[model samples]
Target: MIINCGPLTGFTQARYVIHMSTGKRLVLFRLPSIDPTSSKPNEKEGWSYYAMEAECPHAGGPMADSLIDIEDSAYVASCPWHAYDFNVETGESSVGIKACTYPIDVRGDNVMLEFPAEDGLNVALSKIEPVSEKVKLKNARPSETPTAKQEDSGMARYLDDDATLCDWAVHILNTAHPEHKIELTTHLFAIFTEREASSSPMEIGRGTVTAPDQPPREKMLTVNPGAMPRTGRGGTLKSRIAMLHALANIELWAIDLAIDICVRFATFQTEKSSEQLPRAYFHDWLKVASDEAKHFSLLRTRLEEMGSHFGALPVHHSLWLSAQETAYDLRARISIIALVHEARGLDVNPMTIQKFRLSGDAESVEALEVIHHDEITHVTTGHRWLTWICNQEGTDPVQVFRSNVQKHFRGPLRGPFNEEARLEAGMDKRYYEEMPNVVAAS
Candidate 1:
């Protein structure tokens, strides 16, 4: 592969081929790479210069800098800013919530990159030399599918014990860390090709709660069916608390994916057009991740006091479903996960807190309060990123959001929205203002 590196102040229009370890081949520019600051002018393709896959559109994190393409839809890229997992083909961002599919051209065994001329320097079209293919064509496999077995196995491990060790293993299974960066793509694919049965609801230990004749309010203080463990309330209070803690932990997994996507854009390492965002754009994502981490810890501690722990209850896979459906699109992912889910959190968390409060459970309410405060910021981050993207793309945020949501989700949205929280999150008044009419009509 060859790349015609446009003439820059320091580099020539040199072409270079990159033989990726995954057996895929591509071209790299030999001329001075992009400075990631200069604004791009409308130029012809041959005169256009661009950064390789090192930059993410969501968080601006360095992608190509430390990444390995594991398969077609899956690749392990280390976020230079924060360690995260990124799905290359599907753009399924994990950890920091950011990544984008870049444009490239392939011509037989040769690939080419047309870069823009820098400093207003005009140069003739440069012919790039193609490198010879040493290996037989029949032996090379094009990335076509994701490794299902590896994913399932990793998920199984996570389900079984989700301990700190499991966390590190998951990180390795999902990334190209120093020792685990092995190209097990084919192996993983082979193992997970067939669909595996979904997990069954867990059977938690139950204990009779003998309380003095309870008051009328205590009747309403019963556990929420929606949030309760698969095991009935006959379970010890400690066991029930463990179930809530596990629910919180499950929420963290989803947050991790969202966070990586956001970080990818903030630390993006490419030439920024006048319209493109900067590194500062991603600071809010870090704050969101921190909040999620805190929420997880608080819930865990509360569960411990109840004499149980996270992973003691069965959890749903709906969050992972959203992540998978929007894997190829960042706009959809952010809107659904952050705007839809986290925004709803502002309402849901408070309601849950109220439930605990009425039940005289101070510990749960305290944890919910922390979540509520931080969640305000998280929703705001979504609004900021979503609104900015709308401006950049010259689209209506509300319309785009509605269309994407309809395409991706099937559940009904419970509202009587937390208007105050939405306001803090940077949601435009027009959206919330008109929401009632839209919902009523629907």
Candidate 2:
């Protein structure tokens, strides 16, 4: 049961605390202190509302009484009971106890929270503006550069492949307007071809630019995995719109995720003979980002033809969850996202295409066909890189692949896979032949 607390009071006020109580549960304590750096581009200070459990795990002490580290950039909190420190931004406790942070979001001025619906836990907030209207992208491109203080307006900053692409991705993800993302992404890809992939020593300095990985969306509608609505092949028009929207969102996330692989990992490559990664790594992912942008465009166009817009329904950030989960190891990312997630797409696309075909939605079928074709490349790119990374570590590719599946991939690998497509994508049977107890591709 998610609950709305109220409008955050301290935007200009500097600091304010929101204590939500329903008799001893005293469950929520949200304090928003202005982050002075919020004015910087892509930095959304208010959105970083990190709220942890009310009581400290160490001694059941109320966390509301925790000390704030104003001097420190991470803005951590220290429990006074035993001096256990925690990064409030991440809820990471130095003492190793789960902080049990509740998920919350600030949309417009309204602050919302989600917790167990039990014990009559509910609070409403000030009125939220209706979700923003969609704006179509104008295809006109200026023939000459604008020297009027804006030559590099976001997408035009094609300075370096890794850095520019990363900047564009972050900008797209951070744009608060909730505009036509697919169209914006298509325009961004032109910038990719405009620049060369940088081999400038895996720039630890972002090659030139960088931005936080927060993906774009209106105030998020996040919920537990169990909370997602039950969706299937045959459903109402609303359900079909939802299903298509979910797919479109995955492609949207893939755009950032591919760029993330580029800018985040390229720094590891140096002149040292030990660095196994090469320029081709960035190239492969850039291509992946391009393909993803196309996939998004197709799906979004189809959605409009269906009389639905991109943000007409809710979407979860689960695909990006794979990205966040694998932020530490490139191998884990490939194993889970490509081998497990994209591979599942091979299994599911044909059935989806068949569904659209049955409904006489030729437009959807054609768009999905393009997606199906490109996903082969997407999966292949993941396979190629994971295998290379394995070889660099001097670990057996097959064995390491299995290890990653067990370690990072959450569920059993479902199949009835497109065996032909998987093979074309360079995913050999050994990676999934008997691993994780997958069912055979039907």
Candidate 3:
């Protein structure tokens, strides 16, 4: 039996699972040739196609989702569950197990997989089906599907067909109560990470969900940046509380920003785009949102400890204003928010910590230090994705970043920068050192 998977170009995902009518499963891989220009005499020039069983021989891990990489000039797919490496061409594994391999032929641009006539199969690619209904191909090991009892627990809310990752993101953005938003954020992050580690992973639905123009909020007064009350130096208790409240407000907006990007620009992950993002993109932003929630919780707790709270002070709408400006462009959003605003946090964090230290507020100092360390990673995540997008477009990252910032940002770039943290986050001097309108520190 011969099955035509599709055109070679349609395999945007490196690996695709094909379900057979006989209940067997096979994974097709379109690997990169070590030497695209050279091949053995009478063989194809680009020799990089393979087909193998979908189950890992050791434990029934999802081989289709294996991590693909090059080892010793050969393609290798490491099982997600056990890290067992298998050669794509020969199916030879490090643990002395040999997986079944099949013949794959390319006629023109169409990829064809052949099987014995005895094993009849249907003609359907799993990629076109809903993720929840995909066939489960496992070895003789016990199935990892959740039991009825487990499905009835708290995590069941996220396991439903309609409650996709994007759906949860929209739900979080619409939630107005600060504590409830934090609770939902924590639950969604936990569920996603837990399912990803299990045999059954969470589904990231189509990127068609539209984020709200502005996140829901209540009670907390919003004012222009110039009109917001000043948070004086952290020497006195009143000033310290004010500073914490301000920081908490930023963290709250940050949570929305992170989740909003996941849903708002999700279509970029599809094959329709030239630079397709993998599922890892959603994972990264959800992780960022989770960290922001933690930061907000810490600041809120600290405020209550000093007889204050987050909503006690008014905050400027400037942060969300930036979000609105870059709502349609992912590049601009990353450039202005992560590289500009969040990077600024790294610059001022040391001074903020020092102030808390001098005022004998060690707890506040500790909290700021924790936030400072995590902010560096958050900035790094943004830089990494921005660079990936630029590489796909075959453009210089520095030029793209500068262009985006100049197009979306209104004010001059300020100095007295934290050169060390920015460097650690992969922002080189070329990206910001010699801006056209840089304002030196006074």
* Candidate 2 residue-wise lDDT at 74: 63
Tens digit of per-residue lDDT, candidate 3, span 1-442: 6777677667654466777766678887765556767653212445467888888887676676565656677777866444578987789988899887777877777777776654443444444211111111111112254323443333222234447898888889988877757766766776786566445777776665778999989698888889978889998999999999989999999999999988888877322347567776787778778788878888888888899877988887789989998997888888989888998898899999999999999989877887887787788778877887876777787898888777777766678899888876778788787677633232
Of 2 and 3, the candidate ahead on TM-score is: 3
| Backbone clashes in model 1 | 43
Clashing pairs in 2: 416-441, 416-442
| Candidate 1 deviation (Cα RMSD) | 20.2
Best by TM-score: 3
RMSD of each: 20.2, 25.9, 17.1
lDDT of 1 at 182: 20
| Tens-digit lDDT track of model 2 for 1-442 | 5566565553332123445444323333333333645642212443355556656666565455454543245656655334466766557776677666666666666556655555664653332222111223433234254122235344232233344555665565555443334444545554443332222333333445554666566665766667777666744666667778889878878877776777666555422346846645665666677667677766777789789887766678788877777777777777788878888898899998888788777877877887886777677778777767766666776777788777766667666768877876677788787666543232
Query: Which run of 10 residues does model 2 get worst, by summed lDDT?
Result: 127-136
Tell me each candidate's TM-score.
0.45, 0.59, 0.64
The residue-level lDDT of candidate 1 at 77 comes to 42
lDDT of 1: 0.46
Candidate 3 ranges beyond 4 A from true positions: 1-162, 269-273, 438-442
